[model samples]
Target chain A: METLFDQELVVINMGLEDFAKTLKERGTRVMHVRWQPPAQGDADLLSLLDKLK
Target chain B: MSKIDQANKEAVDKMMKSRPVWVDIGRAKDVIPGMKDNLFLHAGPPITWDRMSGPLKGAIIGGLIYEGKAKDEREAEELAASGEIEFAPCHHHNAVGPMAGVTTPSQMVFIIEDKEWGGNTFSNMNEGYGKVLRYGAYDDEVLNRLMWLDEVYASVLKEAVKLSGGMDMKSIIAQALHMGDDAHNRNRATTSLFIRTIAPFVVETEWGKKTDYDAPRLDLTNVSEYFGKNKATAAAEVLAFMHSNDLTSLNAIMAACKSMALAAHGVENSTVVTTMARNGTDFGIRVSSTGDKWFTAPANVPDGLYFSGFKSSDANRDIGDSVITETVGVGGFAMAAAPAIVNFIGGSPADAFDATNEMYEITVTENNNFNIPAMDFKGTPTGIDVRKVVEKNIVPRINTGIAHKDPGVGQVGAGIVKPPMEMFIDALKELAK
Candidate 1:
């Protein structure tokens, strides 16, 4: 816990790209994952996809 | 592995193994299968005359004029709306073209054959620069340039290509990726290599000499008069024309990519995208498993730097079959290889690297042949999987030339754009069914 806290924090920002940009502006290491809601937030499609999996 | 995963593997394997070679040049009417006398082939999926965008509509009008079916633009427009003329997608005929992608009966086309798959693809010969037919300009200047390409240019090139015995387009594409060409919007290196490879043969070409060639031939006997008396002058002029135009190899490369994509088509349950094209009005995609069925959505206008006189408002919606490059993995999927292209399409070098890096998230594999040196020789992202696209909520990116919204205005700019995500969702639903 002490080592973890002593090290720098790196974030993996998903969904919103601006979050990653803001983190980077604050001099934090950040990676922006271009993402969205699975099946574009369609309830029926998401359920169908879950069933298929 | 899951069934879809196995199928996707088979589909992408076929794509990677396929080798496209430039075999011949001939008139579209004589070479392309199912090409009818009055039929005109345009870009993208089936779009009616009413829904056709300005560039596509303008190209059709110009095609009619060049075919001598109409004497003027007014007559061509009337004939187009008269419902007598038949229009179909170029993909329907085992061919692909860039920009407006309008192909008429008399236009000469480059013939590319897939060595592994035994399928042939075709594209119309590229007209070099300003006020060209591919971008929808139809003045006498455009027609005259088309005529010159059909007669003088095609004749020498046909002989030169035959003398070189089939240029390996797949190899050239792989090399171009390393030499700073994404092989869609930026093709300076590809064009240079094309001119270098054919220059010797272009000089050796005997205009009137009859030679027995293996591929289907277009009878240029009548047009031999266009070559004139001087051999050196003809070769010099052809070289100069190719040198001046950086897009000389684009149409041929599009045909080659079409052959590559067609090889991956029709693999049982594969979700790999085989075609992604737009007709200015609608963007459409065809998956490997779905066969010929197209899922379409409204095309969005590209955002980028405009020319001196044009603004974003003047730019048309995304257009062209050139996205076939992205489908087979080198256009937008390999942007890191060509960082200089950012200057043309309006982005920083880091943005170019990010563009390519992001694509790997939605693709099935990395292309071994098209590796990027900037990213430590990492292979380019290849084979777009529809399921992955929906699952990850990411869409494929394309960098392209922006045509003017109004026809005959020519190209306004070049930029980056993505097809609407709804097309992928709909395609995924269909695949599930």
Candidate 2:
């Protein structure tokens, strides 16, 4: 299983604990975690993903 | 015929016809009658001035006693009611007042003229808050201080202004704005800078006057600390700056906020609000794009702590021109910069952050100078936009002082509250016009 952090997902609506647990269940190590709400009116998920990367 | 039209007309008329003249300290004598004895001038839209707030009434009574207008408060009140004394707003008379902002004919006024705009403004001497006249408390001590300000401080300022060739307040305001002051509530840095620039000249003038001045006997040590030491002086300086521009700076913010909110006015899809103001008697507001109409609700009682011996019961509804600051993006909007203010209004550091962040949902820009360091150097949210307000369903927050709804109680506590949204909706209807 791949670590969630390795897959680079920007999680919204999920708490840090739940995301970490889900990643562990998948046998993937999540690293380099940061959380911030999306900008007021931006809609580009890929750009958001690029920012996370 | 609409209320918005009437209010807009009144605002515009005041703005256009009133030609503010910048007067030299000495020349100000001619414009504002009996100004040497009392240190304050009136302000706001010129109109038929009426009975003042209780604290203002109290201050005036104290001024009357100080000026020997009456032997006591009862006598002074009787004289004031009898119309023996004329009433005027600090703005109308080219002056600003602190606290009760009361200035009788005998008061001295600091006069600043806008060289470019030809606008002039006045402010009375700062009495320092806490059971003072501006807060509507009238007593022997308040009266006595008025006497000193009139007799000693005003005279000193007059001489200093003459010797220094006149202080350019406009320059000071520009600098202050750059240094994180919205030029209303947060003015510590500006006040300090003013004293630093003028202290030398004040001392020199005292030294030059060998006879009555008694230079050696003069207490000029804290003269430069006027803003810090005296609330009136700080307010006076700001009033002078605001008056000089014909309310350009303030009106700009108001108009900008109005324009920004215009986008969402009358939108069938939105429930956003736009503007709010308290007229001392009533709190009024408008929603996005809803032009100049005001739907007023009873002003709310502010929640916060009071000075020793004072209780919330003694406070008045929120009042003053300071609300203009909130319209354009300062005051409560920038509370994070003044965390200590939370003590006055009641809140925590986290609350301050929350206040600033909440403001962003309703605003258009972030102020460059007035910033919150605790929030990682983020600028204070600048403008309150209606679209965002409706989009996020966030009500604008205001940190305000509660004055006694009655005249005499003065101020009780500082608290946070929301302006009624009904006014915004009314304004939204006007925007449809």
Interface-residue RMSD per candidate? 2.2, 15.3
Reference interface contacts recovered per candidate: 0.33, 0.00
Report DockQ per prediction, comma-separated: 0.42, 0.04
Give each model's whole-structure lDDT: 0.87, 0.50
Question: For residues B1-433, what per-residue lDDT tens digits would candidate 2 score against the true structure?
Answer: 4443333333322222222222334333455644444333332222222524454556567667767878987898787677566655443333444334566666655665544334445555555434566666666666665565555555655676676776655344435545555444445545655665655555555522332331112222343255343322322433333222222232222222222223234433222343455544456555433443456665555667776777877766555434545654566787666666665567686787667777876665565534556667676675554434433445577766566655445566667666655544333334433
List, residue by residue over B344-400, the lDDT tens digit for candidate 1. Answer: 999799999989988998899988778998898998999999877888777898999
Chain B TM-score, all predictions listed:
0.94, 0.63
DockQ measured for candidate 1 = 0.42
Tell me the spans in candidate 1 whose CA falls farther than 4 Å from its real position: A1-12, A27-37, A51-53, B208-232
10 residues in a row with least lDDT, candidate 1 chain B: B213-222
Interface RMSD for model 2 amounts to 15.3
Error of 1 at B136 (Å): 0.9
Model 2, CA-based lDDT: 0.50
